[model samples]
Structure formats: structure tokens, C-alpha cells
Target: MLKKVRGTRKKATLGHIRQETVYLAIQALQKDESLSIQLLCEIAGIARSSYYKWLNRKPSACELENEQLTQVMLSIYEKVERTFGYRQLTLHMRKQTGKKINHKRVYRLMKLRGIQSVIRRKRAKYVRSTPQQVAENVLNRKFEATAPNEKWVTNVTEFKYGHGQKAYLSAILDLHDKSIVSYVLGHSNNNPLVFQTLKQALQAAPGSKPMLHSDRGFQYTSLDFKKLLDKNELFQSMSRVGRCIDNGPMESFWGTLKCEKYYLHKYETFQDLKKDVENYIHFYNNERLQAKLNGLSPMEFRNKAA
Candidate 1:
């Protein structure tokens, strides 16, 4: 009956936890009684040889190097507010330390250290709004470009501040190097917000006739917006109705922005939100490295190509 009760009392436990518990028990027993290691091992259900091996083991050179690398990774992870996954962490590590660290090693170390990127928010579906005028999908999801300002993608995203007070961010992203060309944040998702974003981009890069692509939103399809694009000698490309993937790179930038910054914190004031948005865009453009860019930031890649 006692054995039955003992069997019924068993609970599942982790291997390391069980090992630590056995070591503790052995230590306590050794303090009061001179028990042989083998006896203690037998009682603890561990091999006496294994106990001695663990007691005498020293960290290998590889282990020590891993420990140092883990510390470096933790520093980078915290510095970036834990926004990087293993691949980005690996890139940053190699660049910062000038070490050829493998991404798989970084993945293992991150797993062991319980380090991970910030949780990403699920993408929201876009509502198909009626358009005043629509252009053909000339860009046709050709996201890659050979030179700066050769292709641009633009979109407007909504954010909420105090008590559901909404703000809209309209921005254009250059396809060549994944850099944000220009951005405007306002309280209304109106035509001017998007128009200003385009004007800023055009003013920044005058005489650059890029194919400007956008979703079939009211702002993008308006007659005034079309006239502005025509006046600048820019080709206007609109995503087909109900096909959000046609403007995929622009959509991806929004996902990256919200995942890395906006979703991580709450903003009680509009000013604070706006400031954070500006800071994040600057970081995205100047500091944050992309793997596809060979561990260079967006601006770095652009300047290198130039």
C-alpha cells in the first residue's frame, strides 16, 4: 500500500531540475553523515560515475566563447528593445565584433538564453474603398529596383492614441534600398496627408521619374493626386482592387514598423506617439541592418550603390 501511494504521488519534472534536486540532497546528506558517493548515487537514482564527471567537469574553450557571445547578444538584444530575431542578431554580432559567427549558432544561443524578438501583431485586413480613378498595376509586384528613386511604394496606416483618438501616417518607401523616402503624420486620413508625403518625396529627389505604386485608396485614386503624379512626370501604378499583395513591399514596411515599435508600447499623448514614429523611422533608415542588404542599413545600402 505504501509503494502504491508512492507511485501515485510521482509528478513529472524536468531533467535538470531533478539533477539539481539530487545534488542538493547529496550535499545535505554529506554534511550529517559520511555516505559513500555510490550509496548517495544509488539512492538518488543517478550513476556515481556521472556524479563525479559533473563535479570535476570544467567549461571547454568553446563553452567559454559561447558564454561571452551570449553576453554580447544579450547586450544587443536589450539595446534594440528586443526587436531582433536570431538572423538580425547574428548580423549585428558579426558587424559589431568583426567575428564570423554563424546564424545557426546564434539561433542555438538565443534558444538556450530564452531570448526572442518582440511579439508581432497580426495583420489587419484592408477594406476595399471606392476609388474616383484607378491606374493600371504597372509595377506588378516588381519590388526590386536597380537605382535609388527608380520605384516607390506608398500607403497610409492608422494608429490610435488617447481614448481612441486616431492618427494617420502616410509614407513612401523607395524600392531600390528599402528606405523611406518621405512621411507625413496627421490626425486625418485625408487627401492632403498623402499628397504631402508625395510632394516631400518629389522635392527630395527632383527630376527622378519613378513609378509610384499605391493601393486603390481614395487618396491614391483622386483626380488631384493623379494630376500631381502627371505633373512630376511620375508614372502612377495602382494595385488592382481587393489585391493588397500588389503593393506588398509597402504593406511589409507597415508590418515591420508596427511589430518593432508601435505594438510594443502604449502612447497616451499624440506628441509622444509622433516623436516615437519619427525616431523609429530614423533608426530604420540609419541604424537597423537588413540581411538582404549584406548587414547594412537602408541608407548605407543606398549610399553604397550611389
Candidate 2:
């Protein structure tokens, strides 16, 4: 009669027992004095033989190492706010621990842990504008440069903070090392904002005549902007109307900045937003490693080349 009652209870509870739950019950047997081995096995819909086998089996060396590596990956994942995918995380883990960890292994471990990088938000559509005049597409998608300041691309991106207030970021990227030569944040995307960005770049790299490329924005097409470029003897190049990819490198940088940093937070004040933008740019130049640059940051690549 007792055996019949036990069978009925076990059958009723077995439907709810998952493999994960069975594992948990096995673990609990070690800590809970009231959980008898036989009862756990019955409740988990597993044979006493299977429970004993799992309990006596020791983890392999590879399994133990994978557990440890998963913990390290978690630390890095949180440190970067999950901004890095498995590839970048692997590079970072190798640098920090000097362990020649394979990226494939890292990818497998990250998958098991359900750790992943953030998804990038798609950028807004480009508004085609008819300019009175535009410079030749002198850049012609020749994005690579053999030396610093040889080819430069400039663009302005907008950000919002606190009740629809907008901030404009104008910056120049040197194609040689992908470094931001100069950047300016302003309340308005006016001619002055772009001019100041240009002025700063000119001052930063005095006597360097480079091809400066930009989109057909009003500021970039202005007469004043042309005069300033001519004064510095810079070759002015403009992207075709609605063709953002003409300045692909510069657009790529913006996407990186937005995906990795700007989109991660909300700012209540312009001051807070500006401070974060400045910090991210500094990190990008100094700390963030690039695969194309042989795992060096932008500034590192530039300095090594120099």
C-alpha cells in the first residue's frame, strides 16, 4: 500500500521536473539535510543510478577551465556595459590576462552564458539638399591614407538632451589612423560650429594640406567655409546629394560612437551629455583597441606610425 502511494506521488510530480531542476535538486542534496538522495531522485524523475553517476563524476579539466573563463568574460562584459561582442571581448581578455584565448572558444562560452553586445540603432535617413554649388567629389571614396593629415573627413551629428534640446558635434577624422584630429560641440549646427571645428583642425595640424571631405550640408557648402578651406590650401570635396556612403569612414565613426556610448544613456542636462561625449572620444583614441590597427587604439596607431 505504501509503495502504491509513493508511485502515485512520483508520477504526479515527474511532469514538472526539468533537467535543470534535476541538477538543482542534486546540488541541493549537498546542503539540505532534509533532502534524502532517494527522494530527490524520485521527485526529479531520475533513477537513483543516474543521480549517483552524476554525483560521482568529476568535471574534466576543460570544463573547469571553461567555467573560469566564463567568469572572466562576465567581468569584461559588465565593464564595457556589454558594448563589445565576442571578438572584441576576446581581444580584451588576451590583452588583460595575456592568455592566448581563441576567439571561437570565447564565442562559444559567450553564447552559453547568454552574454551579448548591444544592437546598434539604425541612423535616421539622410535629407537630400540642393546646394547652390558644391566642390568636386575629390575624395572619390579613397578613404585610405599613407600618412596622418593626408586625407581628412568632417561631418556634424546631432544629439538630443532634456526636452528636445539638440547638441551638434562637428569633428574631423584623419584617415591615416582614424583619429579625431579635432572636435567641437555646439548648441547649434551653424556655420560657426563647422568653422570652429575646421579652425581647430588647422591649428592642430598646421601646414598640413589635406583633402577635406564633407556632405552637402549648408554649412559645408557656404562661401565662408570655402574661403577658409582655400586659405589653408585644403582640397575641398563634397559627397553627392543623398550619398552618405561617399564619406563612409566618417559615417562609420559616428555609428560606432552612437552605438557604443551615446545610445546607452539618457542625459538630463547638456553638460552631462557633453562630458560623456568628451570622455568617450578620449577613450576611443587612447584605450579602445581596433583590429585594423593591430589591436592598438587610434592614438597608439598614430604615434607608432609617427
Candidate 3:
């Protein structure tokens, strides 16, 4: 050694005397040919009576109960692809098994077993910046409509699967009913898909020229899209660049679609994804409840308006 260290030398001092004694006793027993209660107590620096007391006592009822609870938690975790966290697991236990288990117990059990939900990593993607020649915000964030075809919001959202293949979903939602007036799923993020969706929305709206709102995606701002809007006599409204709140309702719809449906299910093919989307859209329009619509579905709201 370069120098002899003296003083208290607190840098590497053992934190707990009891823990150190326990570890030392374990080490001594491993080296010993046989273990005896008296010898263990001597090595642990504890009284022999205390060691005998621990050996004679049985596990508490609560300890036994925790073992049973842990088994149930393990079963539920295995059943759900290890994706259910404490809250979801608790909910599943109550609903599926009719067990009134405490959340704290579930949390403790999940922690003890090292069972955890997988978190999806956020991916960075290319977002088109708003053009320098920004349009006036005509819609002004008015999301409610008294009848179908009064207000509509359109947006393009991208999805990808496996090896670099991406698909764009362009859709128009009727604010009056919270229903998808039109939607198109396509391989390319081009004007054709956007125009096709708009055409379908116009057809669905029949005689109405709805105020169409959308983020300034190239598809929305293209000459062809503008010409179609002008020919249809529809009011065009663009959201301010990067201001999601300007088009909050459509953003909310997209979030719900991704979180509640898309994130949970994996698609192997574009057609499969399209079919699932179609089914979900139908359910959203005709069956899913909307709190703003007094808990009625989009189709119900439309019928009520009629």
C-alpha cells in the first residue's frame, strides 16, 4: 500500500450490523460440514433461544395468503402476453374472475415477480411544415355541428409494418355526428387518395358543402385538392402549422384509434389492416358512445338530429 489508512475509515463501513451478522452466519454455515441451531446462533452473534423460536414458529396466515395471490397474478400475467400492468390486471381479475383484490396487493405481487408491461417506443417521423403563405383559420376551432355535413375535419395519418412499407390513411369526419364521412387507405401519400376520400365524403354528404378543415398537408394544399374544393363550393379551412389544438377533435379521434385499437392489434397485411379499420370505423359510428353526444353513438346522434 502507498500509505497506511487510519482514523474511523467510514468510507466502507457496513451499514447494518444485523445484516452483516446474517451474512456472516450464512457464510460460516456454507463452510461448515453440518449446520446446528446453536452453532448458527453463535456465528450470527444472536441468542440460541431466538433462533429456536424462529424455527418453531409457522408462517403467518397472511404470508400463506400472499403465496396464493401470487399464483393468481402469475396466471393472469401469462394469459395476457405479459402486457397487463397492475391496473389492467386488477380490472381483469375483478371482471373475469370476480375477485375483489386490492390494487396494492397486485402492485406488490407484480413487483415481486418482475412482471411488467411493454412500453412502445415513440418513433420520429417526417412532418411537413406549414407553408409560408398560411391560409386564414376560417373554422376557428368550432368543433360542434347541429347536423350532418355542416362541419368536417380531414387528416392524413401514416402507418407502417415490418420492412419499411408504409400506408397512409386519409379520412374526413363529420363533426355533427362524429362519424367518418369518407376514408381511404392507400400505399402512397399522394393527391389521388386525398381527392378520392373527398369525393366520397361529398357523395356521402349528398347536397351539402361542408366546411372542411385539415392540417396543411401537401395533399390538402395541392392544386388538384383546391380545384375540387372550389368546384364543389365547399369552404376550405386549414389548421395553423404544428397547432394540434386548432384541429383538436380530429386529433382526438386519431389518438383514440391508435391507442384503443391499433396499438393493441398487430396487422400482417394491408388488406387485414383495412378490414379491421373498416370494422372499427363502423363500430365507432354506429355503436361506440360519445360523451359529448349524451352517450349516444355517432349514428344515433345523426338520427337524433334528423
Candidate 4:
């Protein structure tokens, strides 16, 4: 039987006293040569039976493994700068440690240790649609694509900096890789920004008349925009009025970008914010790991497929 417990052992000894506690009291008397067991137990406030029981108790294998797991969780959480929630953290843990873990246990361990990702709330924002009829919902919330450029989604989001100053970002996303094929930023949230993004996407991907989808914003419904689509033989699709979920993937991307990077920083100028946004897009494509992507970045997944 062990005479002493490691420092990590619980101090609570209920039933009989522990051998470790009795040994401790004896050792103290040996060192001091004057303190009695009664005085030691009185000062320690542990009954003799409780101290004896604690010293005799041995840790189970499962309990020992849990301590190890907590350390691993802390290592990975700091390594990623705490960008991942429990799901992604579980993936990283399993990948690095080669240990199969139930995700619920990971969640529990993270909670117990107070290790968690930053939680940021999302809100809905949109431009009002035009009165005229827009393109039909050909895609109809079917976001999957087997090949690049098979389906493309486009949208513009607004950003503010420098006290009431504003900027707009127009981006085109490919359904297959969830990659931003092209993007453009401008002071005006108008036809020019969208057109530039669309044209760049066309040049970059050069798909076989891919279905270009968007909401029925006035920029999308404009005669020139439709003519541009018609001229390029790009089929157009639109979300119905008041249904942002029709563009769920695109909306989710904005929220992820904001939560992971944007909301964490203080941007004093449009130029500084724009540069960081550009850097984040690159990182999202090449460095950031996604749970849906099977632990690969978007570019890594696409390249692996190729």
C-alpha cells in the first residue's frame, strides 16, 4: 500500500482515515520530535479514519487519462489562438494525438477547464429588392457543387470605419470549394462594385455558363447587369423576397469572417481595415481549418481534389 498520495489527490477522506495521512502525521512528529498525533489531526482538521482512507485510495486509469486530456486541450486551444469551438478542437485533438474521442467529452473537458472559442452574435442586413420580377430560383438553396464554377453566389457587405466613413465589399463565392473566386471593394455600394466582382470571377474561373446566383438587389436586377449575364451566357438565379436563407452559405461566410477576425481588432482607417480583410481572405483560403473541410483549408481541399 502507498504511504503517501501525490499532490494532485483530493483532500477529502470520508469513511476510514488514510494511511497517507497517518504517515504524514508520523513524519511530522519525527521531524519536530514534539508534535503529537492529536495535535496534528487537530491542526489539519482531518479525522484519523478519513486520513487513513485517503492514503489507501488509488486512482483509476480513466481518471488519470482525463488529466492528460485536459493538458492536450489547453495546448491545442492556445496553438490556434482559440479560433475553434469544441467541434473543430476535437478534430485537431484527435488528429494530433491519434486518440479517438467522443465529441461530447471534448465539450465537457473544455467547459470544465474554461477553454472556449470566442462567441460572437450575428445579425441580418440586406438591401431592399426591386419591384420588378427578378430571376427565378433555379438553385433553390441547393448549395452543393461537384466541380468548381458549377454554381456561384455573389453579395455585397458594408463596413464602417473612421467615424461614419463607409466602404462596400462585393465578393463571388464558388459552391464547390467555398472559395472566394473574386472580390472588389469601393466607396459606392452600387452597380460598379458588383460588376467588377462578377467580371473578375468570370475571368478567374471561366466556367461553362455557370449559374450565377444573388438576391434581387437593384444592382443585380439592373438592365446592364442582366445584359452582362446574357452576353456571357451566364445563367442568373435570385432569392425570393425576405428569404436570406436562400443565400445561407454566403451569409455564414460573412459571420465567420467577422467573428474570427474582424470583431477582434480595432480598425482606425479604411485602408488598414481593407488590408486586414484582404489578409484574412487569404488566410481563410490557405490556413484556416474547417470542420466541414475534413481538417483541410479551402485551398488545400481544392488542390487535393485536383
Per-prediction count of colliding residue pairs?
A: 0, 0, 0, 10
Error of 2 at 252 (Å): 1.1
lDDT of 4: 0.79
Clash pairs for candidate 3: none
- In angstroms, how far off is 148's CA in candidate 3? 1.3
**Residue 263 Cα positional deviation in candidate 2, in Å, after optimal superposition:** 1.2
Q: Between prediction 2 and prediction 3, which has the larger lDDT?
A: 2
Best by TM-score: 1
Cα RMSD to the true fold for all candidates? 8.9, 9.5, 11.7, 9.4
Work out the TM-score per prediction.
Answer: 0.83, 0.82, 0.61, 0.74
Candidate 2 global CA lDDT score: 0.86
TM-score, candidate 3, is 0.61
Residue pairs in clash, model 1: none
What is candidate 2's lDDT per residue for 22-61, written digit by digit as tens? 6655677656766677777787678988777766779889
State in Å the error of residue 70, model 3.
22
Off-target runs (Cα >4 Å) in candidate 3 are: 1-125, 129-134
